[model samples]
Target: MTADRITGITLSSVTLPLKAAISDAKVLTGRQRPMTEVAFLFAEIRTADGHEGLGFSYSKRAGGRAQFAHAEEVAPDLLGEDPSDIGRLWTKLVWAGASAGRSGASTQAVAAMDVALWDLKAKRARLPLAKLLGAHRDSVRCYDTTGGFLHEPLDRVLENAAASRAAGIGGIKIKVGHPSPAVDLARVRAVRESLGDEVPLMVDANQQWDRTAAQRMGRALEEFGLTWIEEPLDAYDAEGHAALARSLDTPIASGEMLTSVAEHHELIRLGAVDVIQPDAPRIGGITQFQRLATLAEHRNLTLAPHFAMEIHVHLAAAYPHEPWVEHFDWLHPLFDERLEIRDGRIHLSDRPGLGVTLSEQARAWTVARADLREGTGT
Candidate 1:
């Protein structure tokens, strides 16, 4: 048999329109407007032996085109490389785009290719991604975030919360920081009342709070017995988060906004968060994510992966310590396979790789495309 060499790579940009505008603390603070859609950059790798693999990275509200463009520029470097050498290929793509810098859009672009390579390898091994990574469990604790976006009314939020628990989701996370601390408090109180004491609840400030507000909110929220308070302050404010973690009984979680492992290292080193929340695509890809995971595990931090549940459920399961994976329904239309959410957890499927194939709807949503072959680019 011919050795499996990457023969071609195709990148597609798909726009997933939201049923209604999505708003969170960032929008409420005037830092960003309501999000009407999400942009996904999909990388499909075709190997010499006819195997194909797919992986994606996403952007909310902006930078879709930038991620796609950056990937296009550097993807030609991937042709003829061994697909099994995912780490080395990731490094090659990073250096190919080094002039554009390494963290934000640059690494985000490389993340798609990096993930695809991993998926390809896992599929070749005929194992699900979590199994390929040596899963600690078959399922991961799950929480719902989409149902509680700040854009919805309080009643709708409550309804979503009740429905989420009914659907076997283990926990609920609501956006806090709506410009009125009192409103946030009222919402939390109502949700707590609705969900009762047994169900887990989490709140996210989305980094709208200052030190004073975070301190005040942290104290006020202690009564609720939340799972954790996420993004209580600016993501980069390690010292502030460290102090808050020390001061409050409720665990503090952040780092989802950070775009690299080195940046996450600073957050971990500062002892800023008791529960660490990292988004794999935002930080790089699975390779980079595993690096960060090792560091977090060494520190013995609670793992709560943020967003991209299809991807994160697998990563979370592979964690030795129990981990929580955020459930967001926004990306559901993009894939044919639906993750099983039962018994308050996301369970792994028997299918190989990520267990997802692009839906026709996903292909229909494509707004841009590019292709690179061993000898030519299209």
Candidate 2:
């Protein structure tokens, strides 16, 4: 008997809206904005003998419509290609448009297709994604940042940090960059006091400060002991980051906005950051992120990936030296199987293809291009 060859490819864009009420300001800048939503571009590949594979791409930003159009435009290149040769296909797709699509939105669109193909491959093998990626651990330690924005009062910030600690979270991350050094320092102090000296506390400024402001604020928080200071300066200021890292006791971490292995390599070589925080979608996909993880390992650095915990969980589980996965209690209700987080530890899933199933209700909320034309929904 001969093996079946891939015969065709199909693409669909799905959107899921948040059931929880989103606060106006949060909806604009917070993690769970009033319209906490996601748009996914799904790809399905069929084989000669009836076997099939499925893949998808998603983004939380408002420009997802453009991303969908880009994916649709690229679908033709993937049609009839061997779904089994995912690596080869990924390389070809990335190299095909090297001049025009090597990074940025183009690579992100390609990543959506690439990840979906990997999911289909895992499903066909009837194995978990971690196993497919070379599983090294069954579980990953997580740090909670569910208390986003840090707009809450000082007591409330400590309260949330204490709750995360009690939940068995290995650490806690709080938002900074409130345009107040004293206020940011006080918040970090309160959280540390509440969690005590042993529990790790991390802070993120969200790229809201310049070098002077970051250094002043970072130095003040150093006494409290932070796991790392994330994105203190602009995401693109590698030299500034290197300077800040040298000046501070807490490790400087950035790179969530970085888009390619080349960029990551430069940041690493520059000694710009001690920790690499790659967002799966932003970094082109698991393939590129995995390659970056290897580079981090070789350099004796930590891999603390950014959001999209569902995908990060699998990636963390596969890499032996992965430091910790950020846990933001968003995106759970949209998927059928939520990533299991127990007492700050994220347990890996045995389900195939990232173990996420899109609900019909969620899918129905998706804002298609036609929907935009009708102007009926967001």
Candidate 3:
């Protein structure tokens, strides 16, 4: 039987305050400010046959106000398309913004709808997303990536690391670049000392350093045994990233800013990064990521996706060397099915589609935030 076509698309915005403030101590770019909360643009797509899918677009900056605008503007373009023909739909949307540049905000907007289509397709197939994508393993490994210097004290950071390790987490990621390389080095060394040798430790500077500083600091911290260094330079600096990758012994990982497979291809061909971290919300959704993963596989590299652990957990489970999924702990309160991570492995649910549903209370709570509706416009 032919799959039902996409008949309608709806978009909405929500803001949720973080349990604690997230600060980038390693202010590599803009002035470091305390982030009040996260904002998301959630899209729901419905097909002619009544199957539906859900996807979200979010940002730590501006709480997703601009992203929501992009989604609202693009929704009409997706009306009446075949949900099953995700590739075709993605191409149309990518071309919709061809005159203006298909990569950044436009691509992020397309990713939201594309992900919704994939979710809808999985639900229509009556299969979990990982199964629909072709599951390579039953459970995927995950690492905690939420211990920020702004909220968690040094003692608390160690405590969280210990708790995660004891809980059977296979890896941990710490935030760095609060401006002092020495402090960053100390923090990473402490975590490594605490976790010992078995559990992998990753660090994200959040685009906090220039090439020279990143190389200098990265080399200093290399002795601590980091699994990878993420976003050390600006996300857009492919050549800088390549230089840093060549300079360091630890793997260089970036690409949360990437929006298409072409960019990934260039980065791979240039040997810009060792590990590729594509955010499903930023990179034209799951279909493009699958294609990128295939390319990375052929190049003898690993796929370590960034953010949205709910979605990445499924994608990671379907790959051969997708070692770790980033665990930010932001989506737990919003969804009914909080992922289960036992012994560092994320176990997928048997429920149809993505197996995530927003709680009524959460929806109401999100709607009640009037301040977020004002839109910070970052």
Better of 1 and 2 by lDDT: 1
Question: After best superposition, candidate 1 residue 134: deviation in angstroms?
Answer: 0.6
Of candidates 3 and 1, the better by TM-score: 1
Q: Write the per-residue lDDT of candidate 1 for residues 1-378, one digit (tens) a residue.
A: 557899999999999999999889999889999999999999999999988888899998899999999999999998988898888989999999999988999999999988898888889999999999999999999999989988899999999998999999999999999899999999999999999988999999999999999999999999999999999999999999999999999999998999999998998998999888888888889999999999999999989988888888889998989999999888989999999999899999999999999999999999999988897765
Give the TM-score (vs. native) of candidate 1: 0.99
Task: Enumerate residue pairs that collide in model 1.
Answer: none
The lDDT for every candidate, in the order shown, is 0.92, 0.74, 0.77
Badly placed stretches (over 4 Å) of model 2 are 1-3, 7-10, 14-38, 44-56, 95-100, 369-378
| lDDT (tens digit, per residue) of candidate 2 on 1-378 | 565555566556667564444332223344444445667665556666565555555666464776677665565566556677777877877776566567777787777777777777787788888899888888888998776455566777777777777777788888887645677777777777778888878888878788888888878888887889999987889999999988898999998878888888877988989988887777677778889988888887888888878778888888778578998766665567777777568888788767886666555655552211112111
TM-score of 3: 0.90
Q: What is the C-alpha RMSD of each candidate to the true structure, in Å?
A: 0.9, 5.0, 4.6
Using lDDT as the yardstick, the better of models 2 and 3 is 3
Using TM-score as the measure, the top candidate is 1
- Ten-residue stretch with the least lDDT total in model 3: 369-378
* Residues forming the 10-long window of minimal summed lDDT in candidate 2: 369-378
